[model samples]
Target: MNDEKFLKGKVALITGAGSGFGREMAKCFASKGADLVINDINMEGLEETRDIILKDHKVEIFLAKADISNSEEVNNMAKKVSEKFDNVFLLVNNAGIDSGLYASLKSKEDSYDKVMAVNVKGAWNVTKAFFRQMKRQRQFEPIRGKIINIASCAGTENGINPFFGVYSASKATLIAFTKLWALELGPSDITVNAISPGVFLTPLYKNDPKVIRLLLEARGVKLPIDKIGEAKWVADIALFLASPTANYITGQNLILDGGMTISINKL
Candidate 1:
């Protein structure tokens, strides 16, 4: 951990913090001295994440178990956070889901609705509920608020796999929102940005690494790094985006694809 503590005295809210990128980001933010408010639909997973953070970082952690897809639930969670912390300096919209391979085609309506609900609406609900507090914080305090959306590289790619169409569309929606929100909030000094990651070895593949490798290989996805990414890689980027260093960078989609986007010929 860096001793600089750039995020000292800040409060950060991370969605889908049960595991994967969100979990790692939570840990990274906590290490920098920010108090945390982490939420997930999975209570057990949320508890595990809280315990892990508590073990290493001494920052306060508030565990909220709420399904981000539900607007009412998300609004209530936001109220709770505001009541507890009064303001949140960092908001990481990291909750998302995807229909299993080929399932999007088989169950188009269900898959599309589910993916959109969690990925698109979930981000909207949380942001809408917290935007006022963020703006207020910017006005009264010296800190600037940040909203980091976790989009996917599939959103930017022109020719995506049909099996991932719904998932891709949802992420694309989020990327669009990131730009729009940045424009709307820039005047208030609230920076909004999106992160489009290519392939990261998170808990999603703990059970079947070979399957993921074959999927990427079949797509002719070759990166200069010649390896998949880690959750820590994404977490580090989140840390940078949330820190003061990223004050001037807004409305940009920072693609952390290990040069894969430029290396591979577009399909």
Candidate 2:
């Protein structure tokens, strides 16, 4: 556990913060004394998340409701955030959607369109909207900032499953973007990375226990850690990346699948 107030006065922007990983990351960062700019399509959930955090942590919470899939909305959101905070030092692209279970080969065009719009283009939109702002912050600090893309193990063989082909491809593209953007942004001292997490009982899974069991079995029979993941597990890794300790780490995809990918690679 990190000591208190290590991230005091820092500003973090997290998208898809209504629940699950986004909410958990918000809480974790708040606990460390980071003011937040949280976004979600669900205003009620976002408000609730803000209230939950304010009760315990004295951190500023700025809520923005916008669809990340739309570039215009994301640009407007960037402008809105600029009014509250000078710059967003930490950005977590946590908003993504999965296109239900089906053979991706026969999946409808609409399905792919929606998934890519949110999972791939949505991330691109948010990053593009704030790239210059993050880069400009370099004038004050050697390290401009950190951009954490919430990719998935599904993008790799580690967590790939029978019906997640579309989501996997989208996440793979996200990983590629991470590498390319990191290379471009390196000159400005801005770090870009991806965290590929495995099976977790997020709201998507909690909504359907059967789906969780199916996903777990599809990923693997057993993981080295022999347990399911929680949002905090990924949040802890995000916390490390957001901190100055990760100043030298960029353009990398950190896997947090409890060795599930390694086990899969063995077979």
Candidate 3:
């Protein structure tokens, strides 16, 4: 961890902090001396994340348990934020669900609705909840708050991805929110962006290393990047976007697939 502590006096709210990108980003933000408001539907997972951070970093960690897909729960979390912090310096909407491999026609309507509820509508609710605090800070302080949406490459490209219809559609909707919200929040000095990751070796891949490699090879993803897309890489991009260097960058989806998307398109 860097000793500079660039975000020494800031507050970052990361949804889905129970695992995956949310966990990685929360750790990174805390290492930079930022207080954390971590949310997840699973209380146990959120506790694990909080414990992990507390062991290494001394920053304050608030466990916000809420189902982001539930608008009432999301609004309550926002109220909790108001009662605790004056402003939210960074909001990362990482609480999204994947519908695995399924064709649109074959998949049930409930599956589609569930995915949309978490990935698109859920993110909207969280962003709207935090936008007030971020905007209010802009009025009295020079807070250039940032919003990061964790979308997916399957959702980004125009080309069709086999068996990922509902999941892709949900993520595509999130990317759409990133662009539109960035525009709406720009004048208030809040930047909105997204990270579209493909082929990431997330915890979702529950298998041995060799077995995972064989699975990837069977699927034809023999990329030379060793690890195609690591969660840390996505976390790093989030940090950079939240930094002063990205003051002018907004409404853009930074693709973090390590050329998988490009090569597929070219080939």
Q: Identify the leading candidate in terms of lDDT.
A: 2
lDDT of 2 by residue, 9-107 (tens): 678999999989999999999999999999999999899999999999998999999999999999999999988788678899999998887767878
lDDT of 3 by residue, 86-197 (tens): 7579999998887877876777889988999999999999998888788877533454688999998878773247657788888888899999999999899889999998
lDDT of 3: 0.84
Against the hidden true structure, what lDDT does model 2 obtain? 0.87
> Model 1 misses residue 120 by how many Å?
0.4
User: lDDT values of the candidates?
Assistant: 0.85, 0.87, 0.84
- Model 1 local distance difference test score: 0.85
* Candidate 1 regions with alpha-carbon error over 4 angstroms: 1-3, 103-107, 139-143
The order by descending TM-score is 2, 1, 3
Q: After superposition, how far is residue 184 of candidate 2 from its true place, in Å?
A: 0.8
Ranking by lDDT: 2, 1, 3
> Candidate 1's residue-wise lDDT over 110-198, tens digit each?
77788899999999999998888888885434446999999988777642556467787788889999999999998888999999988
